[model samples]
Target: MSEQYPPPPGWSPPTRPPATQPYAAAPAAHPQQRPRQQPPAAAHKPGAIPLRPLTLGDMYDAAFKIIRFNPRATVGSAVLVAAIAMAIPVLATAALGAALDLSLATELTSGSGGESVTTSVDGADIAGIVGVFGSLALGSVLQGIGLILVGGMIAHVVAAASIGQKLSLGQAWAATRGKRWRLIGLTFLLGLTTAVLLVLYALSWVVVVMTTSGWQVPVVYGLISVPLFAAFFVWFWVRVYYLPVPALMLEPIGVFGALGRAFHLTRTAFWRTFGIALLTFVVAQIAGSMLSLPISFVSQAVLLGGVPGEAGVFVLVMGQAIASVVTAAFVAPFTTSVATLQYVDLRMRAEAFDVVLMQRAGLTTSGGNPRP
Candidate 1:
C-alpha cells in the first residue's frame, strides 16, 4: 500500500457528492477474429495521483506527477509561465510609459519660443491621453486575464495529473471550460489592482532618482523605502495569497469574502503556509539553476568554439526565455499542486480527512470502517 498521509488544517472538504470511489465501467468488446492478448491488470491502473492520501511530499510529487500524466501540457505550461514572468519588466515599462504619456500629456509637443513643443493632430491631445491611459489599463487587465487563464488551466492539469489518470488536452480544457473566463476576470481584478499599486511603488523610486542630487540621495531613498516596501508586500500577500485563486476555481466568492476565507483557513498556520510556499519557490530556484547550467555551458562553449553567427540577439533572447521557463516550470506544476493540496489538507485536517484516507486505504478504522 502507498504511504498514509494527512491533509493540512482548517480547510472545508470539497463538497463533492460523497460516495464510493468513482470507477467507470469499461466498454464491452466484440469477440474479435483473433482477439488481441489481454493486458495485465497492472496496465489498467486508475486515477492520476494514485489512491494515496495527501502528504507533505505531495508538493514535490506534483512536479513529477504532472510530467507523468501529460508531459507535453506540463512542458507547454512551463513555457507559457516562463515567458510571462520573464517579460514582466518589459511589460512594466510599457505600462509605465503609457500611463505617463496619458497623465502628463500636452496639446503641443513643445513650447513656442524657448521650447520645441509642436503638434499637428488637432483635438488629438485629449484623445491621445485617453487612448494611452486606456491602453495601459487594458494591458494590465490583459496580463491578469492571461495569468488567471493559465493558472486555472495549470490548476486543472495538476489536479487531474495528481490522481494517476490521463486527462486529454480536451479533458483538461473541459474541466475548466465553464469557468475559465470567470477565473480570468477574477485574476485580472486582483492582478490589475496589484499592478497599479506596484506602479505607484515604482514611481516613488523614479521620483527619488530624478529629484535627489548625486547617487547618495537615491541610495538613501532605497535604503529607507526597501523595508517599507517589503513590509507592505508581505502584509498584502498574506491577505490574498490563497483566497482569490481558490475562490475563483471553487465556490463563488468576492474579494472580501475570499480574503476572509483565506485568512480563516490560514489562521495560526501562516508560518506553515509561508514555509511550504517558500520551499516550493526555493526548489524551483534550485531546479532552475541546475537546468540552466547545461544551457550556459553549451551557449558559452559554442561561442568559444568559433561557432559562426552564434549568440545572435534574438537567439540569446529566445534561449534566455527557454532557460527561464526551464527553471520556473519546476515551480509551476507544484504551484497549482500546492493549492489543491492546501485545500484538501485544510479540509482533511478540519473535516476528518485522516479517517477518510484510512478508509480509502482499506485500514481498520476506529469505527471498523471509515465514514464515507
Candidate 2:
C-alpha cells in the first residue's frame, strides 16, 4: 500500500502483571509476601526481531493467537482479502470488454443507418466487440459475488476445523459484521494507491525509452534505472504489503497508522520480510505457470490457427477462463493465509504473545478470547 504516513511512532508494551501465575493459591501469613512462580508464558512465543529459531509450538502459538483472539474473525478476514485480491483486475478487464461488446452488438442490429452491406458489416463487427466486452464484464461481476460467498464460507469452516470453536459462517461475518464496509473501503483505497504507484513505475521506464537518445541508451541511462527501480520496488513491497490488511484485521489503526506500523515492523528485519515476500512471489509464479500460463499459450495458438471463427474464440476464452479461475482460487487463498500468518509472527515477536497462547489452550469461558 506504499506505506505512506510518518514513521512508526515509538511503541511500548502495556504494563501488566507478569505472564507467569502461581502454581497454587496458599493461605499467606503476610499480605506482602509473594508466591514463587514458574517460567513466563512469553518464553513459549518468540521474542524480538532476528527472531529466535521457530519451533512447531511457536508456529502453533502464532496461529492460535489469532484463533484465541477472534476465531471466526481471523479466518473471515483472510478469506475476504484473498478473494478481493483475485477478483479486482479480472472484473475490471471483463467489465470493459463486456460493455464494449454489448454496445457494439446493439449498434449492429440497428442496420447501420440503412447503409450498404459493407456498412452493415462494420456495425456488426462493432456489435460483436461490444457483446464480448459485456459478457466478460458480467462474468467478472458474477465471479466476484461467488468469491465473497465462498470466501466467507471458507473462513467459517476453517476456523471451526482448526480451532476448538463452533464457528458458523454467520458467526464469522458477525465477528466483523458492521465493520466490513469500513475495511472494504480502506482496503480499496490502499490497493488503488499501490496500483497507481506500480503503473507510474512502469511508465517511468516507458518514458525513458521514448525520450532518451539511442546510441548508449540500453547500457547507460535506461538500464541503470532498472536496477534502482527493482531495489525500490522490493524495498517498498516488504515494508507495506501487509500493513493495511494487518491494520484492518488486527487493530483499529487509521490508514496512516497502519502504514507506519507495517514499515516500523520491517525495520531491523528487512531481509527477513524480503525473503518471505520473494518466497511468496516464487510460489505464486510456479503455480501460475502450472495452472494458467501453459493453457493460455495453447489457447493463443489455437485462436490464431485457421479454424472456424466462433469455435476458435469460444475454445480460447473458455479454456483460458477455466485455467485462470483455477489459478486464482488456489493462489489467492494460499498466499493470503501465509501473509496473514506472517503478520501474526510479527505480532508475536513484538508483543510476547506466547503467554496469551498458553492461556487460550486452557480457556473455556464467557468469550474464550485470548487477551488481546
Candidate 3:
C-alpha cells in the first residue's frame, strides 16, 4: 500500500464509492393529481345570540331563537296574560250586549208609539252604546298594557340569552318588575299619542266637510288628504316604532325620555327600522291568520252544521277563544322578540353595545371567542 500524505486540517478521508448504476431523474407528478382538501370549520354554539352588529336575517333568526331558548318565559307567559286580558273584556261585552238586547225587546213589545216606551228605549240605547264604547276602549288599553309587559319580559330573557345565560320565567319577570310601571306608562303614552293623532285626522276630515261648498268639494279634499295623511302616518310611525322596552328597563328614563331616545336612535336608520318593523308586523299577522283561520272555519262549520241554540253558541265562543289563545301563544312572543332584537341591533350600531355585552359575558379575556 502506498503511504498516504498527512491529511489537511478539517479534512476527511474519502471512501471508495460502491459499485452501482448512475442515478436517474425522479418521475413527475400527474397533472390530474388533486391536492387533499382541509376539513371544514366547526359550527357555532346553538341558541346563542351574537353580540355583533346584526343583519336583517340575524334579527329574524334571533327573534325566533330567543323564543325557542325560553318558551316558558316568552310564549307561555304571553299565552296566559293575553288569554286572561282578552277574556275579561269579551265576557263583559257579551253580557252587556245580551242585557241590552233583552231590554230593547221588552221595550219594543210594551208599546209601539207610547212616549214613555220611546224615551226609556232611547235612553237605554244611548247607555248601551256608551257602555259598549267604554268596554272597547278599556279592552284596548288592557291589551296594550299586557303587550308592554310581555315585551319587557321578552327583552329580559333575550338579554340573558345574549350572554349564554338561561333565564326562568320568574327571573325574567323579576328583571322587569322595576320597569313595569314605566313600560305601562310608555304604552299608555304611545296609545294616547296615536289616539290624538287619529282624532286630529278625523277633525281634519270634519273641517273639510264643514268648510267645503258641496259634497263634491269635500270628496275631492278627502281624496287628496287621504294619501297625504297616510304618508304622514307612515313617516311618524317609522320614526318612533322601535322603542325597546330595555331602554326603559335598564335605564332611569321616563316615557318621554324613552321616546326621545328611540327617535334619536332611529333618526339615522329610519328606512331600515321601518322595513324591519313592517316586515315583522306583516309576517306575524300572516302567521297568526294562517293559524287562526282554520280554527275559525272549523268553528263556523260546527255552528252551521245543524247545531243550534246555546250549545252552538257555546261551541262558537269556545272555539274562537281557543284560536285566540293559540295565536297569542305563538305570535305575541315572536313579535316581541323581533322588537327587542331590533332595539338591541340599533344599540349595537349606535352605541357599540357589543363591547359592553362582551365584558358582561366575560368573553374579552385570553383570546376568548365571541360569536358574531
User: For each candidate, what TM-score against the reference?
Assistant: 0.54, 0.58, 0.72
Quality of model 2 by C-alpha lDDT: 0.54
Clashes of each: 18, 16, 0
By TM-score, the best candidate is 3
- Candidate 3: stretches off by over 4 Å: 1-47, 86-144, 365-372
lDDT of 1 at 113: 70
lDDT of 2 by residue, 60-141 (tens): 4544453444434444444444445445444443554443332222233334577534323355456555555465566666
Tens digits of per-residue lDDT, candidate 3, 22-129, equal 554445758677446757544233235667777889878877777876789999888877677667545755675565532334343335565445334567655765
Descending-lDDT candidate ranking: 3, 1, 2
Candidate rank order under TM-score: 3, 2, 1
Model 1 ranges off by over 4 Å = 1-55, 69-73, 76-148, 158-166, 201-225, 252-260, 300-311, 351-372
The residue pairs in collision within model 3 are none
Whichever of 2 and 3 has more lDDT, that candidate is: 3
